[model samples]
Target: MKQIVVIGGGPAGVEAAVAAAKGHSQVTLISEGPIGGRTGWDSLLPSKVWLHAAELAGVAEHTAEGVAIGAVHVTPTEVLNRIKQVAQRWSEREAQRLQAAGVKVVHGVAAFHSPHELIVRNDDSQQTLTADAVIIATGSVPRFPPTMKPDGQRIIAPRFASHLNTLPPDMIVIGGGPTGSEFASLFSRLGVKVTWIVGAPGVLPMFDPAAGAALAAAMTAHGATIHQVDVERAERTEGGVVVTTADGATHTAAMAFLAIGRVPDLSRLNLAAAGLEVGANGQLAVDNYGRTVAGHIFVVGDAAGGPMLANRALAQAWIAGRTAAELSAPGYCPHTVVSAVYTVPEIAQVGIVSGGEGELQRVRASYTASLKAYLSDETEGWVELIYDAVNRQIRGGIAVGTHAADMLAPVALAIQTGATIADLAAVFAAYPTLSEVVFAAARAVK
Candidate 1:
């Protein structure tokens, strides 16, 4: 059996080890902390739990037929405890699954002893393991420059955002990306004053402009004060944190959050010992198959660098595992990955966009046209579908509204299968549903 070692134990690492085991290879997974890594513990799942609570509160506030519900005031410590419980449950479940699949799961700090060898050390033990091939899925950590540091109290990193014992009366979030925006939204829902500092032209700048604008408007409606200021550095004060902007302006708040971005965490890997080089920013250069310069060492997930998302990591991990184990597997293409931002009215997009170096046409439909949306009092949404006018094949689409992620899947499938606008329009969807928005957009494509 081909022996494989996977490092990091995040979604990517766990998935890679599982894939290798499925390919009939002997696999070992090494994780520095709990098996879930950041996604399972800090980022994805916890945020979803908070978002779910926010959504329930929203639904209660907008209850129709004059039904009145008490105000929802969530206790921060209890919420944080809930997040920890959920994360532990998921980590244990994943660990159990990996063990059942015949993959050895080790908790330790791992570094490359050689290209084919790993030295793992825990508090009380150390071991040396050899593998035919190694997969590095070590994920990433929040990037904080020396000029701006998190104090774990007033000024905080995204990882510690959920652990706050009490919500500050006001917050200054320094980043316009998904993390910052999600926190801003959460604070706004919980009746905290938020000053959102956006470095980009607008929120979710990488997505379709319309979606970003809609989200900004929604945030503003929820009492968030939006500012187009780029934070250069931050300093903690006696009472709070002071953030200095690029234009020499300063903003103060009871608490500050740096959701700027993330860099791969490879401090302990000792890449040089494995005949590999890391970039100045700590990112590893990898090929389309997540292979490093060293043929035997492969990198996946956030370490490989693209959109830093859990689903993308899982996909890359599967491909890397299969390739490393010398098993037949379908190659992964970066363009096919789906991006979703889970705000109140979520935004999801995939594939090539309109007016982008081809004969592409764009069509739009509003959630107001969906009977289900109207019934649910969530009619503030829209869909923009782009298709190749030459062959009528769907190229890409954006969904911004209630269940936008779910609504965008069939369009993503159409793009994947080279299905035409006509093919999607002809399909029969259940009436009074948000999915009908897709059919409307397809039919409107002239």
Candidate 2:
């Protein structure tokens, strides 16, 4: 049987190890931190827990007349504890699953001594492992600027922000991507003053400009001050932190959350020994099959470095693990990756693809058109569908408002299956539902 070694116990490494074990390979997973990486612990899971809390807070603000809903206060320590408990449970569950799948899980720091050999060191112990194949899924870390460092107190990154025991009186969020936007929204919901300094003119640069504009407007209405400027430097202050922007303006807040970006964590792994050099941006270059320059080695997850999405990591891991184990891998395809921003009245998009001019068509349906949204007093968002004008086939769709993420799945499936606007419109959507917006969008397509 082939022997496979997978590094990093995050989403990618765990999936790869499990998939390889199912094949004709003896799999061992090496992880320095707890398994499940950032997705299960520091980043995705924790953020969602906070987002859900924010959502619940938003719901409580709209108490019905004469309804005696007791005071709901934001408890930062309790939330942090809940985040830790959930992440621990997930990590433990993943470990159990890996063991059941016949994959050996090792807790240690790993570095390559040769192409096929790895030296793993844990406190007070060490081991040498050799394998016919290796998979690197070391994941990524928040990129801290040289001029400004996170003190883990006033100045912090996403992971640190999640673990904050006390809510700040006021906070400045740098970087207007998903992480920054989510933090801004969360703080706003917690009744904390938020100043969002977005690098881009609008937030969520990856999505349609309209979606960003809508979200920005909503955040502003909900009490967030936004600056379309990039943070250049930061300095420790007597009270908190002072941040300077590229536009030569200085902002001060009780705390600063740096959602700037992330870099692949390969500092421990001396890649030169494995004949791998990270790209200029500190990302590992890998093919669709996740193979690096050294054919015997593969890369996935944040180590492969595109969007830093957990689903992408899981998908790539399946391909890399099976191929490394000499099992047939299903051909990888560039599919529509659906993404969402879990703010109140969430924003979600599915299967977006670029097309030639005049060939691409867009149609929109407003939330106000849905009776359910009107009844629920959530009539402030819209759904948009993008389709090929010539072929009339749906390419992608975006939904914003209550249940936006939940409403996006069917559209994503339709896009994947090459369903047309007419096909979407033909679906039997119940009256007054949020999903009716999708059917409305499809029917509006001309």
The candidate scoring highest on TM-score is 1
Off by over 4 Å in 1: 354-358
User: Candidates' TM-scores?
Assistant: 0.96, 0.94
**What are the RMSDs of all candidates, in order?**
1.6, 2.0
Residue 168 displacement in candidate 1 (angstroms): 1.3
Per-residue accuracy of model 2 over 1-446 as CA lDDT, tens digit each = 89899999888898999889988889999988898777788788888888888788777878666766778887888888889888999999999989999999899999999889999999999999998999999998878879768888898887874678898889998878888888888888899999999884568888777778888998899889999977899878998899999888999999988888888888888889988887887877778899988999998888888687777788889999999988889655445567878876587787764556798888889987789887777888888888888888888888888888788878878877899999999985789687888888888765
lDDT of each residue in 1-446, candidate 1, tens digit only = 89999998888999999888988689999998889988888777888877777777778888887677887677778778888888889999999889988999888999989888899999989999998999999888878888888889988877775677788999998888888878888878877899999884669888878888888999998788888877788899888988888889888999998888898878789888898888876788887778888988899998777588778899899999989888887777655677888887788888876456658888899988778887898888898888887898988889888788888889878977889999998986799899999988888766
Per-structure clash totals for the candidates: 0, 0
